[model samples]
Target: MEDPNPCERAKKWLQSLQKIENMNKIDPREAPISLDSSNIYEGFVFRGLQIDQLQEGRALCTFKVPPRLVDGNGIWPARVIMSLVDNVCAAAIMTCDKPVKVSVDYNLSYFSTAKTHDEIEIDARVLGHKGGLSTVVVDMRNKITGQLVAQARQSMHNLGGLTVTPRSKM
Candidate 1:
């Protein structure tokens, strides 16, 4: 379920944004970003991220893999991994306040691996954004299994303006 009142949500965003801005180092372009998970979707909350820090074009998130995220054969679904990576990657570069964005390309490299009920951590960094294009990289690894299920680098295009909207799981 989502908190649908834009007015109330905006108030919460401003309050939290101000707090983060006051105590943390941030960039000018990131002023409007909100770290509160209330803005994030519930599907992502299935794995749930433990966000340690948020900086302009940078973020660190940790996920505790649950058995529900596993497929019937006892393997983590590639879609699940991809979704996790996508959420962090998008959020990492999101606050530039661009109204519209489209994923131009995404490249992922799988190293070790992740299993059911494992805690995975990912670090995402924005590489660059020129014109309307933005590029970012994410490093993902299973904390307990010490396996790297996948890492992805993506390019996105900021469409026209920034409009924060709830995205349902695809």
Candidate 2:
């Protein structure tokens, strides 16, 4: 009562600091990701693709496509579709920590096409993870019709990348 133990005081201080950090940190569990309005994905009202469930080393991510995500060919660009898929696959690998790894190889398939206003769902699973390489399965679908528009696999290297570098002209 007269004097607190130095060790006990240090531990209590640490716990309080941790609680404050948790309160200040973003809770992706309850809220949408906070992307700046000027971000590329935000350029078109990007929606959150979240992992709704997981089992047996696999996870499922459900997404509702926005009305504005489109491409030049007038078809939903494979790149955009892949972007959603990548988010899901990486999210699975990142089930623990987002800073753990980056996507390296992403393979996709387009069984059908979508209009600019069409809604899509992306489902992904983990095939395996070895030596810093993660293999995942992803599927794209029409949100309303429930049609399977695409099935694909994504491979990601364990290296971490906050953003991928775009290819440039030679």
Per-residue error for 16 in candidate 1, Å, reads: 14
Cα TM-score per model: 0.65, 0.58
Question: Positional deviation of 3 in candidate 1, in angstroms?
Answer: 18
Q: lDDT tens digits, residues 1-170, model 2?
A: 56444333322322222222222453546423333333334324334444456544445555555445566655777666765566556555554332235666766777888766666776666787777787889877888898888888877786544455789898
Worst 10 residues of 1 by lDDT: 14-23
How much lDDT does candidate 1 score?
Answer: 0.64
- Candidate 1 lDDT for residue 109: 82
Position 17, candidate 1: lDDT: 30
lDDT of each: 0.64, 0.57
- Clash pairs of candidate 1? 98-161, 98-162, 99-161, 99-162, 100-159, 113-148
Among the numbered candidates, top lDDT falls to 1
C-alpha displacement of 112 in model 2, angstroms?
0.3
Tens-digit lDDT string for candidate 1 (1-170): 97434333322332333233232454446644544443232333332456666666776777777776677877777777776666566667754443225787989887765676777888888898899888889988877666777889988887676665889999
